[model samples]
Target: MTRNKGADSVQSEASAVNAPRMTDKDFERFSEFIKREFGIKMPPSKKTMLEARLQKRLRALCMNNHAEYCKFLFSPKGLESEITHLIDVVTTNTTDFFREPKHFEMLLSSVLPDLHKRTNRPIKVWSAGCSSGEEPYTLAMVLSEFADKNSAFDFSILATDISREILQRAVNAIYSEDKVEIVPMALKKKYLLKSKDRKKRLVRIAPELRKRVDFRQLNFMEPFPFRDKKDVIFCRNVVIYFDRPTQNRLFNEFCLRLVPGGFLFIGHSESVSGMNLPLRQVAPTVYQRI
Candidate 1:
């Protein structure tokens, strides 16, 4: 017996209600823009944030709202460097020091100890999609404690992001108390300097930690521009924006850049199980290059 057409129609209607109201054209524009500017793959759930960010842009430009802005975006001048400015305006970057505590705990308890035992050379770490400097700075602080001033087994951290504004802010290393509140008191005292001025209620990362980290601008989808095999990479949360195929490509590239036995830390919601890479699962959201 054939299924009833009405039943299928009812099922389709239910799916529509659960789905976001974003149109295919709107999603397509946002996807293309994000891919070009930040090497991020756009997930379906990002429709709300993208709409909210770009809606304000539309109002600012005084164009015919999102529809007109979309058309203008496809114009000759729109696809140029203007796209970078667009992403800087719309994408949401939420990060904090030791944001995912487990990853850091793993690093301090297990990963660092092993790396230290193996070699006396300064460890090299890359914080791809470093986003506003928290992850890299956290890496620096942990490595500082772990390495213990031998200076031989010291560490250098390279943190990169696609946003120049965020990069500059990351380099500034100054943060409001609200942002730094979650950091432990001992860590806060060690790695952060509290501002005393009444006008500026902020904390700045200590010079010692800041100097160990090098901040640069990098788009991950492009070729691997920097050369050393990375000992550790914290690329968490960034890839959730990417589609499956893009995620696969990124994992492949990461495998190439990571040293054997190097660690790749991803967001709690991300994994590489089906990516067909040479990485072995170490923990939830953590992988070791095999």
Candidate 2:
């Protein structure tokens, strides 16, 4: 037993010592690869983050060093998997239910009602870059409330992300109490139910709410396939990684996707002042597709 324990300890030490040192070159390669593939620009300052996120992938693949991983990624045969992994690791997805509350309030109080009145058809909302599904689920909860008590304004929530892995998790629609704490109390009662298992103090979204959202893997650089003129599109906290030209193109695409007078919500740090899309600023980080 002692011999086996010592051997395991030595193996662990060896693995730690052989782990890849993420240097400037590796960081540049990651940034450039993402840019070329997705038009997403990751700054060199995110080297530490690159290490942290990619280290998981290396560990999964049982790679001892970044050199071998980099070689594999650069090889023609490995390019497809490498680009998919790049999208999974490089895109930052920090979101929650009802994040930036004021925006949701605007969506609930204004956007849904106006769109419902305008078109006899369903109000379509797209949660672009919907990390792990909280945003779209939250949207469904609000829309459900509106639809139940009020007119039967049809609605569908489309949740999309570049990472299939994350999209799968989003489709699962399970989250710990810690993640759902920011969800308003009323919504908590209306849309979520605690799991019977005590080990997991998490809640599953109510089926009624979950049914309203359709989760899909979508890369923003490509032409969006959905033809439904959207009522509101949420692309929050996502564009800061893109270069100015990419952001300009993204805004143009968003304008094309939105119906006239539909809304576009961006990250608080992101703005379209100089890009000059038909969008008019309605609030900080919010615009109307005019």
C-alpha local distance difference test of each model: 0.81, 0.84
lDDT of 1 by residue, 113-229 (tens): 888777777788989888789889888888888867445678889998877788888999999998988888988889899888947889999999999999998876677677788
lDDT of 2 by residue, 145-210 (tens): 888876767788888899988888888889999999998798899889999997889899989888
For model 2, what is the error of residue 67's alpha carbon versus the real structure, in angstroms, after optimal superposition? 1.7
Candidate 1: C-alpha lDDT: 0.81
Model 2 accuracy (lDDT, Cα)? 0.84
Candidate 2 TM-score, true structure as reference: 0.89
TM-score of 1: 0.83
Please list the residue runs of candidate 2 whose C-alpha ends up more than 4 Å from where it truly belongs after superposition: 1-18
Query: What TM-score, over all chains together, does every model reach?
Result: 0.83, 0.89
